[model samples]
Target: MPHITPCLWFDDQAEEAAQFYVSIFEDARIGAVSHYAEAGQDIHGKPPGSVMTVSFELAGQPFLALNGGPAFRFNQAVSFQVVCESQQEIDTYWEKLSAGGDDAAQQCGWLKDRFGLSWQVVPAELSDLLGGPEPARAQRVMAALLLMKKLDLDALRQAHAGG
Candidate 1:
């Protein structure tokens, strides 16, 4: 079967965004880089030899970042969800991805990174809590989550425990 890789569109920061993502995730590495050629310069308006695309892997998942100019921008409609095993992991990802980001955009584990990419730094326990047998607890968890920016696992747990 052919692999399906996610391609991210960036105004002109494909290489920079790829490197930033690689630095934040474990087991990430930069792969092949393609530069824009003179042939498409007339249409694309990008300088020849400039970075056109950057192939990279983040935690073993392949991704492509394209320097597609400022024609498109990222919005909240689509986001990358990062499942975290612990609060510390969530904190690390939140801090790294949200650095220089819009503070107002953060809520219920969702954050917009500096590059305008949206990310959900979610805790693994959230599913179990939200999908447990008791729907009341799930409601409580949701209520607690809605009140904060970055999710607080302890608060969710407390809400689940009927605190």
Candidate 2:
């Protein structure tokens, strides 16, 4: 089967971003690093032999990071969702991803990483708790979730249970 990979554009940090992502996810690894050749230095305006792209995988998902210059940037319009099984998982991702990011951007489990990449570190049970059979309980969970920056699984569970 064919696969489609999401390509991320960065100013000059494709390799750094790829390495950082690999360190965060257990099943991730840096696959390849390609450098710019002398031919396109005029049009691309990049130094010859500089990093051009990086191939990597995060938790089994393939991604490509390109040192495509500052023509584009990452914004909240796009985000990667990390479905966490436990609160510890959420905490880990939240702390690491938000380390050098904009603190004002954190809300409802959504955060922007140092690279300006947006991420959603949410509890795996979040969907079930907010879309379960009980409408009132789910509503409560939604309300609780809206008030949090980093999701609190325990608080969500209590809200789901009408506590």
Candidate 3:
């Protein structure tokens, strides 16, 4: 199968955004960085040597950050979901990604990062808690989930257990 990579558009912050993401994820790294050329100056409006694209990887998933200007902006329509195994993992990601983010945009384990990118930091066992034969348990867990910003695995488990 052909490998697919997510391309992120930034307003002259491709390199900066890639660096920030690399710093947050343990298995992340910045790869090739391409600069603009004088040929496209009229259309791109960027300096000849300015950064144009930054290739990066987060949690082994390849991504490309493009300095495509401010014509477009990130919204909640697209989001990256981080499945964490523990509350500690969730807390770390939530803290890092939500830093300098809009507080009003945070709800139900979803947050907008400093770069305006939306992220969903959820527990690994979320499916199990919200699924299964017991509809009441799942409903309770869903109710609990709807009330929080960053997800609490313990609270979800408690709700699933009818506590």
Candidate 4:
């Protein structure tokens, strides 16, 4: 099978960003490091043989970071969805990764990380509710989801009750 992974280009904080991402998600780990060889890139502020690339995983998703120039940045076009089970988990992740960025509820359990990386912190119960046989109940749940950020299950149920 062919192997493929996302390669991220960072101005100079590839390693730091990798560490931050790994710390935020479960099942995350740094695999290896690649450094520049002979040609020194003083322009990028790193020595000739310095670390330039980092291989890391977030939520079992493999990602590579390259210490390239500031030619690209993280945008809302791509985001990560963190399916959470409890409010405690949502609070923890929200408090941790929401640092240095605007944490606003975007309906249906979605928030933007400090780096402007969008994330959806949804409850596991959402799957159960959405999978229910009753179409009206599911519609109610959907309507409720449109007004939430962290996906409060209790509130969603109440919304289903027309409350």
Candidate 5:
């Protein structure tokens, strides 16, 4: 299968965003960086030799960050999910990614990062807890989840147990 890479459009912050992401993910690294040339100044309007694109990898997944100007912005409709094995992992990621982020956008383990990117920090067993065989228990878990910003594994388990 052909390798697919998600390209992120930024308003002249592609390099900055790529660096920030590389700092956050342990298995991340910045790859090649391309600069704008005078040839496309009429269309792109970016200064010659300015950063135009940055290639990066996060957790082994390849990505591209483009300095596409302010024609677009990130929204909650598209989000990156981080499945953590423990509460500590979730806490670490949540704290790091949510720093300088929009507090008003935080809900149910979902947050808008400083760069306006959406992220979901969730437990690894979230699917099992929210889609268990018992519909009532799953509903309870869902209720507990909706009431929380950062998910509590213990509370979810308790809700599933009908506590």
Candidate 6:
């Protein structure tokens, strides 16, 4: 068992979320579904045997989702990032993730989901250059990222080298 795991707090629909996630990613599976007991209080108007927690794996990382009432919610402050090697991959993720035409950021990322979860779709090289040691180079890359909805490494490099 992983000593540490990220647990997601959903208003309800924990099982539905788990199923949705597992269906989207390869190498993913739903591990467990804990349903509310007959003696437990009805939550979300669900039946006593309805799921209260769902455990699943995404890209091989274990995550837990709880039907923990409305105590917490997802926001842009914490987002999952998908790094792509080419524009094709970027488009694929963007299309699937932003299905409902949710809000998009100018820097080549968008937030959308069947469940309203936010995601950042970035080019792999952008993370490489932005995290590189050269400050000037990194700044140039950042500038390039600012103008694009998806990162373009060639343009960023050209700008960095002042070409």
Best prediction by lDDT: 3
In what order do the candidates fall by lDDT, top score first? 3, 2, 1, 5, 4, 6
Candidate 1 local accuracy as lDDT? 0.94
* TM-score preference between candidates 3 and 6, better one: 3
Off by over 4 Å in 6: 42-46, 104-110, 152-163
lDDT of 1 by residue, 110-156 (tens): 99999999999999989888987899999998999999898888999
Give model 1 RMSD, 1 decimal.
Answer: 0.7
Model 3 residue runs over 4 Å out of place are none
Candidate 3 lDDT, tens digit per residue, 40-135?
699999999999999999998999999999999999999999999999999999999999988899999999998999999999999999999999
lDDT per model, in order?
Answer: 0.94, 0.95, 0.96, 0.75, 0.94, 0.73
RMSD in Å for all candidates? 0.7, 0.7, 0.7, 3.0, 0.8, 2.8
Which scores greater on TM-score, model 2 or model 4? 2
lDDT of 2 by residue, 1-163 (tens): 9998999999999999999999999999999899999997889999999999999999889999999999999999999999999999999999998999999999999999999999999999888999967899999999999999999999999999999
Candidate with the larger lDDT of 2 and 4:
2
Clashing pairs in 6: 108-149, 108-150
TM-scores for candidates 1 onward, in order:
0.98, 0.98, 0.98, 0.78, 0.97, 0.79
By TM-score, is 2 or 6 better? 2
lDDT of 4 by residue, 70-146 (tens): 67877767767777778788778766766776655354566666655677777767777776667887788888788
**What is candidate 1's CA lDDT for residue 103?**
93
What would you estimate as the lDDT of candidate 3? Answer: 0.96
Better of 3 and 6 by lDDT: 3
Which tens-of-lDDT digit does each residue in 1-163 have in candidate 5?
Answer: 9999999999999999999989999999999999999997999999999999999999999999999999999999899999999998999999989999999999999999999999999999989988856899999999999999877888988998899
TM-score of 1: 0.98
